[model samples]
Target: MRIRAKQLAFAATAAVALLAVSLPASADVSGRAVKIGVMYPLTGKGATWGKHAQIGIRLAVEEVNAAGGIGGVPIKLVEYDYQAKESEGITIINKLATRDNVLAVLGPCFSSVCEVIFPLLERLQTPVISYCSAKPGLSKLSDWAFRNSLTSDKQLAPVVSRWAKDYSIKKVVIIHDLEDAVSKAEGSKVLPMLFKREGIEVLDILTFRTEDTDYSAQITKIKSLNPDGVGLGSCYQNAAGIIKEARRQGLSQPFVGGACTGAPALIELGGKATEGTYVSTAAWMDDPADAIQAFVGKIKARNGNKAFPYSAPRGYDSLLITANCMNDNGITNEKGDLASDREKIKKCWANVKNYPGVSGSTTMNEVGDGAGGNRVLKVVDGKYVDISG
Candidate 1:
């Protein structure tokens, strides 16, 4: 009887251990909501990009949740508005990392803000993916940082070549925003280098502050140079203003700009002046791909049938990619798994190859920037037409 009792106790212990081993696998799938951080400039100069990004991210989260979310655990986005200020951005990132305890962050959408915040990712042990911060080589600042948008240099090269060839541009005058990091890099560095490579002489380089509404002085200088074309290293608002000012001053030379100037707002603001302007962009909204058309339809439905910037699609793609990493890596989203889950997601993002996003086929290059082909778009009659083909 004693021996039989000993055997019964041993069998009960074995059964309990087996149940414990199996419970965790099921528990992980049924864990608490997964948390993701969304940081964007909702109110200041970068509001347009941020607002559109919010739409995209919201749509993505909705779809993911409706489809049962990450392993049946709903995703909760911890959102914050950085207001396009560098100081605000720093504070928000710190809060997200230390207090909110989100798994990954989506954006803080200005290149300048990104420049300051990316270096902190490694220390925080968090991964950041920017939707549209296109300063060249900013991702190289931290292994934890990645960009879904193309760098200014990568985006400008092909478009510059196309613009130079089509317009027979021999000499160019560059105008850039002095206060904006991406604009400064695009105007003072990327554009000049691209123009030289295309054998187009850079006659002069002019500058303007981000807040400067009047560009008469710069336009006056550009008119004096009489270059075959004008190169712009400015965002949509400033670029539109400069183009309009140039037209007002009777300078009709064609204008070409990098990624920052490619938003639909430029065409809306510049009106007739924006016609014939060439710009580089990561996504072409008019693409006839079935997936792209569906995305546009959804966006239009949500946005009162208005056209959206490249940032929208890029934002949508960022969320999907983050979700994919979580799903594929068996991320538990449990409090105990937060650190490991963050590292796993970071490693997964680092190896993303040919992710067929709504924007394009995105692959993370060695420097942590997305490598997808860019489009050289020409403004015609009030809309961007893909002329890269």
Candidate 2:
């Protein structure tokens, strides 16, 4: 989730116009719908998790609306699909800030997309709550940018340390996607750094691009080296392909994946081959806890009993959190001033104490990133069994 951005100054004027519309003199609690825009890659390569996030956002807004909304104002969710494209995300952000003019935005879940849009939000003055994007330094891009999901550091530390210690693993091979921000951070930076800290040897590092389906060449290379373990920093499908190919090529060492592979699709795509794979992730939808079970039941029921991606619950929690923050920080639908209301929302998010959400109790640090821990789940017979100590 650590996407770098190209310069995007051309759209600055539109952000100014959007901000201008919401600058009024006073706050009034009008019984109006508190409109918030929801953006995600509803249709694309990673659309499975993106759609899951969309469903989670929809479920949350529907539930809140049925409960008579926040402080009597209906919480309306406006949906948009960026198709996992940064350009598309920028366009949608502009629309949400100007034409739709929503009070807040719930995200494009990829940090690459966020990197492109976050800078624009500092002036647009609309807060964006990304449920799954976990770029470590992204929150500093704007005061309005917030994440409810775990960062790569928080999400991968436990997985690396546990596997390294428990397995007494020395040399490891890392296969990750170079083009994706999330994979690059985990595969290239975070995991290697952790390995060095633990005095583990990084046998070899390999790279692939997003949308690359075949990993036979990389697997063949891995089979030759015969490392004790392998780590994947790619998204679920890519990770699945790597794991499947590695197993087929007779490399039986256990596999570990960064949080990007935590979605249900990994299990589905890799089947029996995924059984021993360890993943460090945030969402625990299958946790036996009653609260998680209830939330999972609600979403599964809505989506025809199909399992929603792990991202779904995090997205759900982010929206509810922002809404609750707005209400708690004196953000009235009556605040005719968009500027003042945005400031209050930003401050509330920055100073958020312990927000008990499905992702864990999140507290924002001074840098605006959430404070949370990772759960290491090893796939056992198609289920993610927690093995964290």
Candidate 3:
């Protein structure tokens, strides 16, 4: 009888051990930090642009963490530098999706890079929030791709049309760089057509190569036409140079365009020449909203009152919207489970409407583009001031 009792106790102990081994470890699965994948052009032409975005991302992370984190688990941000390469951007997105298993990705400022990697994101059905690509065709890219960045057509065309119609600016010169993807794809064609529709006459249109820095020959030709206004589809660096040279050569006749004209670098390079320059974008830092003002204050304090660049708000708004979507959807920290949880986040994204962000109330449309209003800023006294109506 004693031996039989001992055998029964041993059997019971073995069963308990087996049960414990079969259960998943609670600590490993729960209370782990959620991981978010970030890809950006951290080098090459987009280095400064990526740095500004990272700042906004960090601000968003800080705000989320302060609010008890998502589902009581803190977020861990994983980043990769795409280096202005389309292939690199695609590779990073794929790695984040399949290997690192990020919940979502936000990055790639240039349209060319985003355009290349978008198909993969569609195949994986991963939610992506791009900051500054602003390509019009992105609306039809996929249901999974979301643009926190402003679409160029929606943001700039209306403002240009209104200004042209109001000023009765009949003869206009549209100058664009041939090699610029955004310029070639959108600016070169759309702006001219929009102007024509507004009853403005397109005076002799000219093309400049992005590689060529000298604008004297082009400026002289534009001056010969005596155009009422000049529309430039230039990068910020080139835009400033053009403005500076145009002013020096007395060719300025209410120049505008280049969505980045409001950038601090433009003001820095162009000096007084950037004054009265008009450009439209997703949102300006000088927004009237309390949250936006507070964010601007933070940036100002950090930068020691040096003006925050135009691209800074793009990053700030992207990260803010991402966190807002995650929090609204009841997503918690699931660092190791991002791949499985991506669908849940995508479903949550559909319901995210009019979420107040630093940029504005970003109301995500059916196309996954943030259909927010655009603000037209005039460079006044080296600062961006919103134009009336």
TM-score of every model versus the real structure? 0.92, 0.89, 0.84
Clashes of 1: 0
In Å, residue 191's CA in model 2 sits off its true spot by: 1.0
lDDT (tens digit, per residue) of candidate 3 on 1-389: 11111111112112223222322212233456767788877776536567677776776676656655554556688998898777798889899887877778887777777788877776876888787777677646777787776677777776687567545688888888776566655457777777778778888778877567899988888888998888877667778878888888897687677554445667777789888777776766766666667777766765667665545676766665555445444454456456556766666555556554566556667777767788776778987777847
lDDT of 2 by residue, 62-130 (tens): 765554465556778888989988889999999998888788888878888988999998678888888
The sequence of per-residue lDDT tens digits that candidate 1 reaches over residues 1-389 is 11111111112112223222322332355456788999987887757788899998888888777656776677899999998889998999999999998999999778999999998987999999999999998999999999999999999998999999999999999999998889999999999999999998999999999889999999999999899999999989999999999999998899998777888888888899999999988988788877788888988898889887888989988887787677666777777888999998888788887776788888888978889998999998889888998
Off by more than 4 A, model 2 = 1-28
Which of the numbered candidates is closest to the native, going by highest TM-score?
1
Stronger candidate by lDDT (1 vs 3): 1
Candidate 3 at residue 103, lDDT? Answer: 79
Regions of candidate 3 where Cα sits further than 4 Å from its true position: 1-31, 165-167, 328-337
For model 1 the local lDDT of residue 220 reads: 94
Scanning candidate 3 in windows of ten residues, the lowest lDDT window is 1-10
Give candidate 2's whole-model lDDT: 0.76
**Backbone N/Cα/C clashes per model:** 0, 3, 0
